[model samples]
Target: MIRGIRGATTADRDDEKEILLSTESLLKEMILHNNISAENVASVFISATHDITSVFPAKALRGFEEWKYVPVMCMQELDVPHGLSRCIRVMIHYNTSTHQSDIKHIYMKNAVSLRPDLKK
Candidate 1:
């Protein structure tokens, strides 16, 4: 089976360190909570709001020695009125036996408020 895991985080600025930290934390939590291994991940797509351009969030994962082999891509999110700012979002496509409903999606820090329905 194939399932998707979602993760998001917020940063105060579009700095490299901030983007890397938030993206790393978000990906780590998503994988840990869902008990997914790097080999199980088919691909990862990351996006940042228009306001963020310091660095590509995907690079953080690519630079990680453990996840260097995982396929990752980054893009700029569509700009819309009242859209979330300084946000980095990730979608992981995993080749797992788990059902879609069993997958855990993480929205951390201020980003958690963006999806109150999943806070529990």
Candidate 2:
């Protein structure tokens, strides 16, 4: 079986390091909670709001020694009016035995408010 783990984080500022660290933390939580393994990962797609252009969040994940070879991509999120700013979101596609309802989704910092139902 396969499932997707969704997570989101917000940057306190427009700095590249902030974006990278926040995204890394959020993705780490998602992966840990879901027990996702490198071999099971199909791909990871990341998107940042227009206000975040410092760097691609996926690049930070790729730099990690454990995930250096994982397939990941980053893109700009849809610029909808009044949308959240400085936010990085990720969708990890992976093969898993867990059910969708059992999957954990992480939303951190200000992004937590965006998905209150999943906040922990």
What local lDDT score does residue 74 receive in model 2, on the 0 to 100 scale?
87
Q: Write the per-residue lDDT of candidate 1 for residues 1-120, one digit (tens) a residue.
A: 778888899987889999898998898899889998888888899999999988898977876676778889898888989988999999999998887777789998778887888776
- Model 1 ranges with Cα > 4 A deviation: none
Q: Which ten residues in a row have the lowest lDDT in candidate 2?
A: 60-69
Q: Give the TM-score of candidate 2.
A: 0.94
Would you list the C-alpha lDDT of every candidate in the order shown? 0.87, 0.87
All candidates: TM-score:
0.94, 0.94
- Residue 76 alpha-carbon offset, candidate 2, angstroms: 0.7
